[model samples]
Target: MTIKSGIICYIIGIASAIAQPNPDRPDLCQGAYFTEEEGAKALQTFASTYHDKASWEARASLIRKGIREGMQLPARPQFAPLKPIRHSLRTMDGYTVENVAFESLPGLFVTGNLYRPINATGKAAGILCPHGHAPNQDARFLEQAQQRCATLARMGAVVFVYDMLGYGDSKQCDHKISKALTLQALNGIRSLDFLTSLPEVDTTRIGVSGESGGGTQTFLLTALDSRVKVSVPVVMVSSYFFGGCVCESGMPIHKRPTHQASNVELAALAAPRPMLLISDGKDWTRHTPEVEFPYVQNIYGYYGAKDRVKNVHLPNEGHDYGPSKRAAAYRFLAEYLKLDLNRVLKDGKIDETPNKILTPTDLQVFTSEHPRPADAVVGDEAVLALLN
Candidate 1:
């Protein structure tokens, strides 16, 4: 094609990005929407649009507005009572785990295990552990989830390891429902609410960390809500790709006729606040060390807080929240959240073997004896009605 035609095509692409997205065909930007060179060029273009702190804030505000509007997010609802239920406290090594359930919406329940340090004296830092897409109903029940939460708890953090919608015991709605992105985001906000409400938690030290789809949640929640003071999104931030799941990319947050932003920009919204980006060589985040991290670091530089943002790249690792990833996160959280890492530290290395993994049945919230509340909404349509 001629240079003139190339320019025309570029203009058309820009126009398409800003055009109103169709509801049915929701302007989805999923995995690897751009190649490495293309992603770098996109960041350069975004940089040109914002030179100084004020300009960057203006651009950031547009991105925030775009996310709120494009996601069709409702105004913050006055939270009805979360009506939290807790049972079966099991104390181990240096931490204790309990089954927990709370309502995010009036009838939409969020389920998980709450991990707290054993014999704590003062208010502890609160950490929200949102799980990624695991097979079957094993979202937060995965051993990695158990280990991290338990280990963090042992290190003196009040950790809440919760399920994603339709995962584990959060069965009120299907995970693939329309506006799932919106619901999960809301659930996350409410999870923060629940965490802060605990008398034992220190509200000022709130932090969040997750992998894959959960990593998507980590940044989204941190970006939209300033309540999250520290963020560690493992193996997910990427300029070349938006998230792949409906719960991650089903909404049109990345593209609107008036604005366009990438996941890297969304993650950068955590600027000035401490954040750790954990990336591996096997996924979309493979370019994070060279591409995504520097862009975000530049954004942090705008606030003169470049030291607060960090990137840990593992070229030999794949896309799961395995041991090495967890170790990196633990160190980051300990340093920033002021947790007693020495509790779980053994011979100069993080020791996770003390965490006892429970079976799915043991961690389940609603059993035959304690059934789902009769007032609970049953389907996606019912939950969406409440949100709308």
Candidate 2:
């Protein structure tokens, strides 16, 4: 009878097209406010029972996958830094944004945006901001990249934000699905070179952040490269498997990562550094943080930097980080990177925070440019230079 029940639960979960709540941890109660730990545990239960596309293994891999790989090794050859792609200066925040480009393979250039702050006495600490999937004009790379880049500048730090190749204004002509993901990963690594190359940048104190797809790249890049001193991956990490309707809405059935890179393992990459995951309580994909953070938190705890990894959840937001969450993420970045805000603000950094009205009503000014921002803006600051 008990075996039958487990089978029933799994079947029901599959039928629902969403994870069914774990009968074991009824206390963590789905769709309601849950303590981070409870959510983590409950999500684990759900991941094991559901068919989340290798969900259980992804969670397990987090704790064990990279034991042999060691830290700071060169990334997969596909994403290893190669020749410089192209570098240009584009306009953003009403000032020039340094655009860095690199070719992942032939006919493929991954571009990104770099923000240089004011009052740099020497090479300053830097941050790399990756964009989420929202038809990239670069504004949506991560809603807060621009604001944080500006803030970091004001605080006397250098920052770089680039659009992922396929998403923004890069001159790439093809959007074949698999190639895009590989290029996205390569762009993350090349971006590290871009930040370190800047004259006004510190290069050592670099950080990275992103949400959804961008957030996925943030941690992956941070893991592959040690230059990142801090990282905040909002809504990107997930139970390597499991299907949340809200989370899986647009996932291409064939294109997702095949192996699990658990939060535990990703945290291991940033073992001594600071890492944070901001999640939404109602989102279905919240399970990744749920199953991964507890174990990953322990890893950080073992390193005596337990406080470094924070799991912040918003009570009433969707998958993306809204204003309050973005603000919190910015604070986390500022505090960890130790940006010298007082100095930059006094003198003015990187062109007085470019403010042009963006459509979608709520889009704010963010400064990550991979290739360049999209040329056509429909509602505010609209331009068509790229197309012509």
Highest-scoring model, lDDT? 1
Weakest 10 consecutive residues of candidate 1 by summed lDDT? 1-10
For residues 48-166, write the lDDT of model 1, one tens digit per residue: 89988899999999999988988888776755699998988888889988899888878888888999999887889999999777545576887778889999999999999888888
RMSD of each: 8.0, 12.1
What's the TM-score of each model vs. the native?
A: 0.92, 0.62
Expressed as tens digits, the lDDT of each residue in 47-102 for candidate 2 is 45423324433443542334213221223444334455334444444233454555
For model 1, how big is the CA root-mean-square deviation?
8.0
Please list the C-alpha lDDT of all candidates, in the order they appear: 0.85, 0.51
